[model samples]
Target: MTDESESMETTNDESQKPESQGRMQILDHALSQARKKIISSAKLQLFQKHLRPIHKKNPEVLKRMHMQLTKQLDCHISEEVMLMFAEEQMEKILDDLDGVIASQKDNKEEAWRPSGDPQQDSRVYNISVKVKQKAQLQHVLSQLEQQNTLLRDHVALRQKKLLGTKRTVDSGISKWREINEAATSIPADELVEFVQKYGKIHRHHTMIPWDDDIDVLVNGSQKEAMSRALESLPEYTLYRPPLVQWKFFSKNITRSKRPFAWPYIDIFFFGENETHIWDKANRYTQLYMFRKADVFPLQNKPYQGSLQPVPCNSPRVLSRTYDPTLCTTSSYTHKEERSKDPGSRKTVKCESLYRKFPFVFRETRDHYVMETVKVGDCILYQTKAALPCWTESP
Candidate 1:
């Protein structure tokens, strides 16, 4: 009777295997579709193209399939999934941080070790070596403690400065929108269209939080008319930086290059080539050029509770100026060495910027840490890993 019951249980388990496999396949398909959709329309359509035959047969069936797929994708982002993501992220961060600390400790410990064989040396020499090793080990440990303390203090100050910078950025964006609205009356010929550029080309429609400048471009041919219209606006003071061939119009430029200051916008005048539009906003260094077609036929994107003009192919322009990819890690060089020579400005990575102006990129680092530690709050992560012996404790 026991053998017969065991056989029946095995049969039941075999019956469920196919069903489990089928469900997994469906989940895999859903995830693939969702990932493609997030990347770009072209990739999303690549999958949908296979369903063309079904659409031709009956439009209603295709519509239902699309709705079902969309529903599946939406439902996959459940709370449980989010919790799992958070947990995994936290684990990776803790692991990386632990690795860094452990490596440093190992290096110091290795350095403090006595060289040569103690057995082959004299008694007096051996005693001195022991004493020297002891002192070195203690010194190394002391340095490690100081390093940990400095790291903790740096992260705390960064968070505080970031929060303050975010508030200033929020207010600055509103002011930028107001300026955009005020300048609407400028003639079509003089304006030729203006759109958000540089750090403003984010998917969220918010400017790069730490950036203290708003970049915009207009027709270079209409510089005189553009200046006159800008001068008429009583609220803003227009200033052109002295000693440059390119006369870019800047509003309250002095407010920038300082911490927590109201971000000023620069209206760059771009010249039209046969097939490209160019801006020499970087003094005499080089012309920043973009395809005229990509820039023109501008589209409105939602920003700061209002729609604002952005280049049609933001990726095309952004890739040329910043990193090749549309969005990934934030990387751009803000500084130019004018002394290098005309048209020879060197570009620096964002990592260098982080070291140079630590306070400004504080918020970005917080986001990175939060993602790494799988904690939703920056403060919580800081508190969790504040101790010098955090990795050693467990």
Candidate 2:
């Protein structure tokens, strides 16, 4: 049963969270800028600050430190690649990766360099780890495996369609159909159910609605909450898009090169203690954490009563219009997350993903207009559903 006291406490708790997030956001930005300036100011300063004589004796600690540094560098590389996006994104990616890696290597305290880490030595290992947290890394690894397997399996089928050997040679292009088919099979409903039953699902949205992008926040209160609520499934992996941001993708559909196949669940977590979710190959939805208070304004006023759960329109959707021209440049998305992989007869799953800013569940002329965003990819939309907004048309 819902405890009256617990419910009151929860209300109080939720009320305070957003304010906490705001204070923390300022502090976080300040600290991040300080770190950036410090890193850029002088390599010696950073090395001296993070390094120590005791560190030499504790090689494990030093190696760990290096691993962490390299990982941060890789995150920057991920951002650079995305900012460049699609055309020659690779050259910029390599250049940025090399630059970040090099700076990290130089700034890397000589005492803690990975030359001492026995478990990992390869560049690929370092590059991959540096880029993703532990969960995301594993997901990417699984995706890589899936990508390779699809390539080999489809090699024969793709050869005839290719005029030259090129398209057939590039597994990304050849295996997309297979990849989409695989992803599309698991219906959104199934995915939502899976998350509810077995996944760690942290859900929230932004306070102030802006015309820019949609925001869906995801943070479970404590360590156990994060672990039990967010981490049960190895089926999905966390990932970084082209350069900077992180997202989670189902391992089942990671092989597709189709932009649509870049399945991602956009999650934003609140206020510090970000350590639990930031490990390499490990994926998290948001880079910054906010407390409940920081995001309270974004919370939908419990329409009708408190028994209903949070509504599903996206933040931007609740506050904005559907201008296709503006939508193209809006830098927001509401696309299908993981396209169905070919050869699968299973139903494609979709959840009612939306934030519903100013969420008033009312009746429209004929249909109830609702704002929606896809689960993994914060893809947003505005459409009236079969449900009437009110008993009578307005």
Candidate 3:
């Protein structure tokens, strides 16, 4: 080859190599920043999620506020944290009050090596817990009785309230033991089976500040098809009749770092193309355009969840049309029309969630029921007691 040609080829390879290296470095840096931000932010997010009421009145109390949160119903905690706390509080905080004992009949102990102090038997890193009859331990228990009388009363009171629905969950959040039971109630094997048998079930944590239940996701095309198919299944003869329609919705933001996947189970049913079913279901759920999809799936791999319905045989399945061609709006004539101005255009974009679907298709219903779990699986699939269709949404 000629010397000039060789030089030219060498230059091209060098240039391309640097550019490729630079792009990779840039992507890596961006990913690192995002991970740091999300993991750090998750700590604070967890705190906010457990504690209800926007602001706590006193700044001074905020120091010990988290510790003393159980008795004072003035504060609140979610089920996830309550479960963690319930396991620890009795031996530490609720000392002398012989009442805070867990009556679980099962003796299944989790076996793991200890990392910290080797006083009794169990230890995990810096936290070491042991069961023994020490000398001053009795005195410390006495101090608990005197200093924290509210501990015993609070324990009994919450146990009594465990019979109700919302209260059971709320009370569980109060004692720290709630989430453990919640987690244990549903077995992991059962959950896996349900997800495998049904479509995907995403337990997503959305942008909503206060933590709710898992974000159940499902696909669009298959969702419609499955609604019709769920009818033939004989197991679905639990309470309600067969279903005909179902709806789906993504949250208001996309590409946003989510809070806690470890803490809660998000039963998501994803779809490939963005479906306007959530918008139409607003008529049924009474929700405004509160949530929106931030990102689109690569192809038709949208997440479809079991919450979408199966056997096409539930009491609640409505109708929906697919319009995946463009980001255009199909016939949507609202009674509250506005004037012809730039503001109207902006408002439409905002109301329709900025992300428009090609066709409005039609409205649908989401009447879901939990079916049986996998063999030896203890997973509890949540059924919507009632649909939150935003019909009166302004």
lDDT tens digits by residue: candidate 1, 188-211:
433433323544433333444444
Candidate 2 lDDT trough over 10 residues, lowest sum: 192-201
What stretches of model 3 exceed 4 Å from their correct place? 1-150, 158-220, 228-394
Residue 273 of candidate 2: its Cα lDDT?
Answer: 48
Residue 13 displacement in candidate 1 (angstroms) = 41
lDDT for 56 (candidate 1): 72
Worst 10 residues of 1 by lDDT: 382-391
**Which of candidates 1 and 2 reaches a greater lDDT?**
1
Tens-place lDDT per residue, model 3, 119-165, is 64333432433334444688788888886888878877887776566
Q: Each model's RMSD to truth, in Å? A: 23.9, 32.1, 31.0
**Reference-based lDDT, residue 113, model 2:** 53
TM-score of each: 0.37, 0.21, 0.17
Candidate order by decreasing lDDT = 1, 2, 3
lDDT of 2 by residue, 138-175 (tens): 89899999999999879857765564666544543334
